[model samples]
Target: MLLKRAIGVAAGAAVVTAILVAPASGAGQADLDSAVREAMLAERGAAASADFGTPVLAEPLVEPTRSNDQGWAFGTTTIPAPDVEHAGPHTAIFVAHRQAQGWQVELDGTAEFVEAVERAPADVVSEGEKQLFARNYENSRVAVADTGLGLPWAEGVAWWMGGGPHGDSGQSRPFSSLDFNGGNGQVLSAGAGRVYKSCLRNGSGLVRVVHENGFSTTYYHMTGLTDLGDGQPVAYGDYLGRIDVGLPCGGSTTGPHVHFSLLRGDSHTKVDGQTIGGWTFREGAQAYGGYAERNGTQVGTGGRITNHGQGTSTPTGVVESGQNTSVNVRSEPRLSAPVVDELPDGSVVRIKCTARGDFVDGVWGRTDLWNQRDVGGWISDGFLYTGSDGPIAPAC
Candidate 1:
């Protein structure tokens, strides 16, 4: 099954509903609800303009989760689309900030909310609070390796890999998402992390987990979500919600299955050749064309792969040159090799393969392993941040 991207439109109106969950003591639920309504109305108007056909909004399944002394509120609301016969209501995730004028609301996943926190006045938000929020935002952007993620289901359960490694934005490049079905339709967290709900209608929507190790995961078209407030912590294998044909964010699903996606920072990272749940995923020549290999067994697309549990590190790294402008990329693994280019610090790179070569004491320490870049040439793995002291990619 292919998953679609959500359309974002913003306009203005007014609608208020009762708080589905209790807010923090002293927080003004009415004011928050009113602000959210305004944002929703604007979104609906935008949707209408985009030919969504008089978009209909439902009361939030629960009160928007609040933090920083109620200075911030985030939650989901449903947009029922009667015109779309095969799809369910499209859900929207929103973030609202309390300003001197009023509550300012915007769609989540954008930088506006985070930037607002960064630019918040000291009088309105304390220094410590600002730092806390800033750290959270940074965590979402930084990429980490060896996140130790597994299948998005319970252990020992056999699930059909209906769609192999594919792009999160439909059938596109960077095959980073997988579709799975079976095991009671229950979707579980692949690892432990903070949970945030986005795109909700009635009660079904998408769930994202920002893993402690810096990687994140998103589960879309899910139903029966728990009453999880934003930023709630969840353990690995925790039941998040159920997979169904709920198109809370305007996606079409042939049947009930969770579109499990692996994310590094805000964008989806390719899962090809990455080992998860004891099976290594190999991307297909085309979208949704790949196989998961475990032991001597190779399960192709549309086949069932058992959740063997646990994950293996993938061949990826970030460039790091302490106190230097860029790290040198050579035609060969040796430092004496001709310099082909310079990789700027903090730049993420794909490790095509690796080979043992001339050792050098680099920022991460001395290593003989040299990483072959996807583009061409080689660089010291020590200078590459692969979250491992040794090599991670295949041998050259």
Candidate 2:
């Protein structure tokens, strides 16, 4: 019922799980158990940190249906809180699809996952099953813009702060404004899109660009717009205007900075789903709040943006296994460059920037790694699974 309201969809659709006839095989059950345990650990860990208390398995995990050639598995787990005075056991439905490497938990939230499962076909024996799997698979995939986005400012400008609630009003909202550090500077488009400047308000000098993915990025408190007219196509990093300070821009602020907001579907929706520089938007949340995820890792509570340096990357990464037990971190983006450090398997490092380098074993792009002391060096991009859009940092 909550899911139906959230998605604005009617309920009473015949229960799909009820119609599931074929049962999961033995090996499939084993894989399902393993995946369920992994999901439980992740979900419970998150819940515990939020003071939700540790959740105990209320009931045995149940497989909803059998898988086809698509190598999909569906199940549900009910977790009950120790303190029953607050709420009942929460049931989390999940779907895991077998990837080339192993089984990956695709969807595992309560409402969202249940909605996906409920949307599956009631009759799992025929073509409807195929349709259900297809829909679930698509929903499991992350939504990303067709074209990659770059920092709105020019390379090396270093004009960013940790993302948080930012707007003209100063109230908590989605998006972030890069602190201009007092002076007006050139503003650029974050990605390729169509430009619109008609809705300027409060002397905000707003410029809105709609990307190919139906999401629009708006730049506020800017002046001296480019000669480009509304509906004109602009490429990523295209000059937009100059950051300005005036009453026309809705909010009061200390210095001139470009106010930026990314809207999906339309300007009204302010959900936290968009990602910039691996930092996901956190609508109505503080900077480094619980909502944002950096490179697939949840930035826990009390996290703050330390330094907004040029070519700096956030979210940590581990040196994965394969090929070599360890990789050399060079002072520069070249094989002949001096070795600055060595990252062993499982060593955690922050990816700083990327550069094209000599092909080593099949890796051509090199990623700059930052150690605990903020020392920087380059390593092969092949060995790191950043869990984000390839490389988030700008080219060095």
lDDT (tens digit, per residue) of candidate 2 on 1-396: 211111111484423111112224544666666655555444443332232233343432433444556666654443333332122122334555554444554343233443444544433223432333344334334475321445576532334343344432233233233233221378888777666563243444457665654445667657777778544678877899887753232234445666666554312234355455445545544432344455344443333221112122444445564777787777776678899888787665665556666655523234433222135777666655443335445555
- Displacement of residue 122 (Cα, Å) in model 2 is 47
TM agreement with the true structure for every prediction: 0.53, 0.39
What clash count goes with each model?
A: 4, 7
Q: Predict model 2's lDDT versus the native.
A: 0.47
Scored against the true structure, residue 44 in model 1 reaches a CA lDDT of 39
TM-score of 2: 0.39
Give candidate 2 misplaced runs (Cα > 4 Å). Answer: 1-147, 155-157, 172-184, 199-204, 271-273, 283-396
RMSD of 2: 20.3
